[model samples]
Target: MLENGKLQRSLGLWAIVGLGLGYMTPTVMFDTFGIVSKQTNGMVPLAYIIALIVMLFTAISYGKMVRIFPSAGSAYTYTKETMGNYTGFIVGWASLLDYLLLPLVNALIIRLYLESLFPSVPPWIWVVSYVAFVTTINVLSMNSTSNLNGFLVIFSILLIISFIIFASIQLYQGMGTGTLFTMQPIINSNVDMVGVLTGATVLCFSFVGFDAITMYTEEAIDKNTVPKAIFLTVFIGGGIFFTASFFTQTLFPDLSVFQVVDDTLPEIGLYVGGKVFQVFLIAGAFAATTASGLASHSSVSRLLFVMGRNNMLPKKVFGYVHPKFHTPAINVVLVGLVSLFAIGPSLELITAIINFGALIAFTFVNISVIAYFAVGQKRYKTGKDIFSFIIMPLLGAGSTGFLWYFLHADAFIGGIIWLIVGIIYMLYLTRFFRRKLGTLDFDEREDTRAVEADVKVSSQG
Candidate 1:
């Protein structure tokens, strides 16, 4: 039940919280607001409402899944159980791309922000320095990882809250250009439904990492708290805060600002907050992205470890957890190397690939719940089952599919390539399962007992 030398349950839960908000804040403003600006024009708040509605359905699905099957390999576990092993491999493999690439991009953002604070330093230098520090922190153990994440999360939240509070004050004084609160910014006359959906698909990327609570299920104390933690983690992302932020567009009523400049939304805070508040925004963004980056590294490496243990992948690297650190030492090191190499790639291209994989995995997770419901009916289904299994999964999958259509060609191509690569690995493993994979790390006796208990209970019911 416990990983060696972990930081205990509370820190694990707190880390989940940090990872959720940290991952959300840095990219949320930068990624989504422009499209919202474009469609709704000045009514950006409406787009946030739309996104929240979409995410709420999925977040609830995640909450239900965490309660039913709490584990680090969330999408992987459910899919493998219902759809079979190979599908699970795809989900696990794709999740690695999502986890690693996003964080690496965030770290690059951190490096860029450093240029403003310390103009003398080279961006690459800052990148390397930040990577080294974060890698060291991760290698130390989950205790340190969670602790550092906690600090960063708190610091980043304060920084963001400062921006929001300051901007809200400006509105109160009637000094800003846009509305104090505008429904107008939420609609776009120019972009069609398809365009808005396309924009929303990519924008939803910022809303991820809330389910990271599932990653710590092994480390968490009292597993029942997981569903609560997962729900809470994503709850902050709803309409209110974003609606408040959308009001900031009132300060710049021209609507031309988004096209006139790149990355326009956060500037709302910077302009309204003044120079001191601007610094806070930059600091917050960096902390958020970095925290998310490290979390991605930590998370995906565990997936690698899990895959190796379960014979889904060649276990060579993942099986080699550090005796001293209780971390995926090699994978952690490899993640650092890969992230260092990955920074300069196109964001849209990378995000599309991430979404492709995540969407498929998301689809599978929904389907798995449905499968459980189907099997549950043939085998002991409850009346509430349809809500949890069929309707939610279908809704989530349908919503995701709507957005999936808007993905870029490169992301589609990249995901296809990744899938091909996983298929080849899987093919090799299937032909030579014993030779290709390493032994699972958990105690076989305990795992078997647990699995048997579930099957037995199901049979009895």
Candidate 2:
């Protein structure tokens, strides 16, 4: 329950990490391995390595912002406070696509995996069921969702470990590739830089939730824990993705051999562990996807809550916090309602669109860091400060901007249309920039300050 009309202060380092991993969903490697293998010419692990490096710069920028401004409003808060309210609103509008479409995509993927396992069940039933389940958990409370997320993440990790062990045994027995460790997956004869980079852009989607831990800055028991958790999530999630894809690719080195690329992992399960293990794979996929959907739902609702409270959106609907649960009850339900559109299922095109929003927000996050510290405050005292505040953010902006440059044409066009819609809406909000509305006001609400103090106390004890 709320101590005084504020969201509960209940999460810590591990819980935040769990939520991040749940959002990233290590099973993403399983779902898209075929495409990554095709694009990278079997060097899927190399693609992930490159993606991880690109994500770290942006992650560091997010960590800095969280330390300076620990609020529920993530990129929106950082951009608006430093770059003016208009820029922040645009960045937030771009990020809304990332936050909103994530759960819908997860729900659609969950329906696909379930239908593959049980052909008798209708698709819409699964989508509604998953949406309702995720929304209910989110509405109950933050701790409730975090605890469940931790448990599911543990199970997902164990399942991947099992795959590695079984695959090792098969290699030892002279099956499939006849060797456990081979450079074939990383150093294929058909290696090309263009294919590898395109694959890297696609795999970058796997790292979407690394910044999500910052959304919980207000709720984290120790404010310092948020940054560490972000790094841990990236490295740990990267490690799992790298390991799982390495073994799977080693077992099936040639992409041309498979009839359906998407069915690669399920077939590997059958080969190594029989029909029962295939069933297990299906179950594990569902659990991982559902866990991701739950985390995505939480992040999106929190984003809406912050925007609603700022009067950027309707405060009554988006800003209403449940007195009993201390959660954004109405926003949670609204996200679930929006996720119903996933009933038809369009994975590749929608995924590209989601990545466009993420890249835009990530690029601006780096810019905001530079603008706030280097230009606004002029506080470059030490070598560490100079590198952290200036050099790092510049590299981050360049890296994400490069990715945005190479985004699929369809995705770029769709994102531009979305931005145009947001621009028109911003005109309505600002009265065509005539009123100079939405000027930044840094006052913390009394209840929010109370929750922050309580969280600090909890951390100290």
Clashes of each: 12, 0
lDDT of each: 0.64, 0.84
lDDT by residue for model 2 (294-409), tens: 89999999998888878888777887888767788999999999999888958888899999899988898899899889888886888987898899999999988987766899
User: Which candidate ranks first by lDDT, i.e. highest?
Assistant: 2
Local error of candidate 1 at residue 448 (angstroms): 13
Model 1 off-target regions past 4 Å?
1-12, 30-32, 115-121, 175-181, 187-192, 239-241, 258-260, 376-383, 432-461
C-alpha-based local distance difference test score of model 2: 0.84
TM match of model 2 to true structure: 0.94
Which regions of candidate 2 are displaced past 4 Å?
1-4, 380-382, 437-449, 452-461
* Candidate 1 local lDDT, 133-209, one digit each (tens): 87887776776777777777778667656666776677678755433554445544653565456556656676767
Q: How many backbone clashes does candidate 2 have?
A: 0
Choose the strongest candidate by TM-score.
2
Model 1 residue 48 lDDT score: 57
